[model samples]
Target: MAEMSYRTALVTGATSGLGRGLALWLARRGLRVFAAGRRVSQLQALAAEAQAAGATVEPVELDVTATDATLERIRALDGECGGLDLVVANAGVGGVTHAKRLQWERVKAIIDTNVTGAAATLSAVLPQMVERRRGHVVGVSSLAAFRGLAGHGAYSASKAFLATFMESLRVDLSGTGVRVTCIYPGFVKSELTEKNNFPMPFLMETEAAVDRMGNGILRGEGELYFPWQLALPSRLLKVVPNPLFDAAARRFR
Candidate 1:
């Protein structure tokens, strides 16, 4: 494992699931964490748990979809926490949409939260990292980004946007001492996946997923796709013929 290079970390969506797991992992690694999310009570509980474990965790109430306010809060936290060395824009939402029953509001929410919110979180932190010339920015995308799934078109498209955005940021920040990592996790156990009734291939538990993600960040990997059992297939899917891919994807529908 790479030695800890970051002293302070900021994690969004820390109230639950992967975000919560990442926050706790960072705290355990002895980094002071600013955990942000919309749920204040859960954040407080997380803070308490971390403190009990002899780690520092400060709960910051935030809703990433509110771009302006979210940016302001991140800036405030950067100053208050003695500047952030790492930022993970892990806040995201998922929805199942059918062509016949697709609600504009639901589709919009997914796009706003996944695409816009992810961009806002990164925008809020990148300026400071650029000025300081040292930091890591991570975006938790998904394996689903490889294709636009029938029932989750908006979600997959949002992730595809996010994956490309992270790549673009990496290109922009080259030689600037600021690193960007995109993690594409497949079928990890989380609140989002807990609702799914379909079979999840190579399903991984939360702790294992968190461990892999932490390792990736520490190693400063450009792009990390976990549980290669799924990632490899997803990568191949990108090159598959549209007709063949459509036939295979229909099983999940």
Candidate 2:
């Protein structure tokens, strides 16, 4: 693990849940934080709290889904913070849908926010990071990426893309100072998860998820899996044969 201190960190989806938790934790560590999200009120509250702790908290009232707006916010931040040391793309959504009867609208929204938005955000910042040859790109993917999941095809597939993308990035930047880490967290109790009707085997609190992510990032882990148990099982299901996976998932049904 490199023991370098970061002066600035940009966290997306920072209004509530895991994103908010990560922003707070980073701020308390004395890093200037640029929190981006659509919720102005909650961003304000987070800014105020983070400011009280001696961290320069700039709450960006920006929509990442808007390409121009995302670029503008990031460009302004480059000047405000001089340069970004770490970027965390944590925006995502969850909904249930079957392959045969997928909710195309929800799937579209998920692809837009989770995949396209992340790629756009990375595009906005990576050029500078590459120019400086110093930075970290951490994404909040999910263990769902390991499997197709029962009724959450869109969510799982989107996360799978992130997992693969980040891993490839890590390899591509091996010699460079820039590092890419993908976070595959298990069930966490948060707004994104409160709507789930099924039981989450190893559900953790947002703070726990925050700690897990931070530790993973600090350790320079190429990929992260929280609570440990949910990590390989999800991956193993895919390896075990389609018939076995179909049988296992039947329990959820």
lDDT of the candidates, in the order given:
0.92, 0.85
Residue 108 miss distance in model 2 (angstroms): 0.7
Q: Using lDDT as the measure, which candidate wins?
A: 1
Stretches off by above 4 angstroms in model 1 are 1-4
TM-score quality measure for candidate 2 = 0.95
TM-score of each candidate? Answer: 0.97, 0.95
**Could you give the C-alpha RMSD of every candidate to the true structure, in order shown?**
1.6, 1.4
Q: Write the per-residue lDDT of candidate 2 for residues 25-140, one digit (tens) a residue.
A: 98888788889999999999999988777777788887777878898788778767789999999988888877778777988888988888887777688878888878888988
Residue clash pairs of candidate 1? none
For model 2, what is the error of residue 103's alpha carbon versus the real structure, in angstroms, after optimal superposition? 2.4
